[model samples]
Target: MSSTANTTYTTFTGWVDPPTDIRPPLTENFTCSVAVIGGGLAGMATALRLAERGVDTVLLESDFCGHGAGSRNAGQLASAPGGDIQLLNLLYRKGMPAIIRLTENAAGHVESMIEKLGIDCDYEAVGNVFAAVSRGQLGRTRRIAKILRRAGAHVEEGTARELGIPHGFLGGMREIKGGIMNPGKLLRGLRSAVLASTVRVFEQSKVVDIVRGNGGVTVETPGGVILAQKVVLATNAYAGEWDITPKRLSSPMWVTEVETEPISPQRLAALGWTSRSGLITQHNIMENYRLTARNTIVFGVRQIERAASYPLPERHPDPAVVADLAKAFARRFPPLADVAIDRTWGGWIGITSTWLPVAGTVGDDVYYSLACNGHGLAQATYVGTLIADRIATGITPDDLRTIWVDEPKFGHAVPMIMGRLGLRAAWTADRFNDMINGSKRHAREGFATAAGGFTAPA
Candidate 1:
């Protein structure tokens, strides 16, 4: 590995501190109607739903619940369909309504969950924007808006200034249903709700093997064995680690994020970001930016790292990658260029070849839900609920049936070398655009250029 690749940095998620009340791991063989693996958002949601239905459910987590991507993500509860919307429109043509409904309902479901469960996660219904940093990207954003509108999604197009985005973004498409939140708090809230339910939850319980039997499934962890009549694999990225999981179900991609020290309210106001909406750039590997309740700005993920093997080892954010993120942050918001980054953190996320969130059954008893791509914050929780309902009632709802696949066949995984080359190529293209637009340099005192390189009101 290159020196840059070998360098490591400590994990420091800026959302919130880990919860103090940790559940004990299972020490004896146990039986349950449903066993959900991986205590992230999906698992917690699944176990909570099953328990609410009076089904015997147990949840197992390698670490504390929400320690994974649940708390590690940028916390944008995006309502717009992820991945390439145009491509998805062409591919899943007749299923567009379901796709639109899924995205919209995902956001609504999360909102209802918070209200019903009385969980406070600083959620804002301010909506999210697919912003553009260049003229090329602005055009692309318009195309995306058209695609989304055609699919019956509610979207509006506007310039950065009109949208109250302080950065030098040209323009963007705004999805009306979703906003931002403290993911750590949200995850902890879900954890608390799940804990209050009758479901038995075990932390620090990593599953080593899964064996299918005549009527039930056996999940073996380091501490004990769990005999479950039905199993829901909410493992996401880690699903590929098990031999029983479908081959090439999803690729594990690691994404990094960093947060800055709190900015003064006056200074924040001067930037014209009054709407407090989250922003996502139009790069191939999109970069996300959002303001936290603490007044700190968090952003990252212009690039992604792929795991080389399954059973991914415990890894930290790379210092070099963190530095790259810092540079990107500075380039985007030049007025806040001097703000100090508090810390950088990252975690694994699953991405599918089709770039669509998928939920399906592996066999008669093993149900798997993986590959939310990058929109798992709302989709994961919603899908988990649907999966639980399906298992409980034996009748798949229309929403659940829309994303289900009988055979879990996927396209071949991209060769490692080719994937790296493609990433480099994409990065090169972004840099080329930056150079062409002179965006590498900080904007003037109070002016920034808009699309077509015209000076715009800030």
Candidate 2:
């Protein structure tokens, strides 16, 4: 259970090794119809769409494409929107239907893209579960499921036994739309398609400044400049580095993930994880667990780190955080309590001030879409395509309007309440509830303990 001793701390994702065909940096000036500033999933999708539509497009990145969260997420293509569902309904109740529709469509887009690109990422249509660790959390799941169903989302709620998830979880809700896949593999597939497309891609090309001029926008880089009719800022958390980006656009949060050593198939079967759907607990800051095709369990995100300043630096998972995650993993999967951790990594993601993804124009000819709030695996890709469609055809689709803000101005990032002390408070509250639930269960039945000197977090 001591994860740090045996785990390899990696600066990059453990899902797939870095690509070898990294395109060279931009060294000369160029002109294009649209220039995408960032080569993550959103930027790549935007440029790909533009190229397919015969629009001359260029994508610029600080590093190679998919070097960010595109390759580093938990790989759960969520059908439900990110953030607390109940709160979203309370505030933006009228817009819930459109939001749900957009999310389900986003997941579908990823599924279709996977098939169209022929990306072998071990994709499974087994939708993810909003699993509960305690009775209160279970009730919350039921309420959220009702909210989602009323909003036209396909959702089902059941007990752990009925849902076919690990017994440690109580009754929870499952979104029937989205599923899981190897995100790095999917990203690599997109990268390959982009490389083969007519769109110009400049890897290692960091955009330093953006200036609007007569009938054009100038994007300045260290080694080159790009003059474009329009510019799309798809940098996500890194958007704060640019002054042109609206103030308080989003707050950057650093989250960690770890993978365990492969477990025997028989042992995995013993856990009664028949559905094999990815599980995300209903805590304020949720923890995600999924069984990989390689027979290893990948999990993380019980705690998150905040960025102190812009232009985020590359970093590895904190040792303490990894050890904490290992403990949590043991409690959730007691059957695999002793499984050694293989590797750990972390990545940066943007959390919006409004807790909803946003897209709008900063000025004439300057468009932006960002902060999918951890649902970027599908939402970002879909939103990117929508932005491209709007730019290429000069018409805004209804799906794009659902998340579009009339003004780019944003208030304080209240979601940052999940930062530092807020995160610790939430964890403490979850543990306290677990203790209460465990005591009540022990009183009803007889006390039982797990093997390997570990007990489930009831």
Clashes of each: 0, 0
Cα RMSD to the true fold for all candidates: 3.8, 2.7
Off by over 4 Å in 1: 1-9, 413-418, 439-454
Could you tell me which 10 consecutive residues in candidate 1 have the lowest summed lDDT? Answer: 1-10
- Mind giving the per-residue lDDT tens digits that candidate 2 earns over 195-252? 9999899999999999998679999999999999999999988988998887777788
Residue-wise C-alpha lDDT for candidate 1, range 229-283, written one tens digit per residue: 9999998989988888888767888888887777898888887787788999988
Estimate the TM-score of every prediction.
0.93, 0.96
lDDT of model 1, residue 278: 94
lDDT of each: 0.84, 0.88
Pairs of colliding residues, candidate 2: none
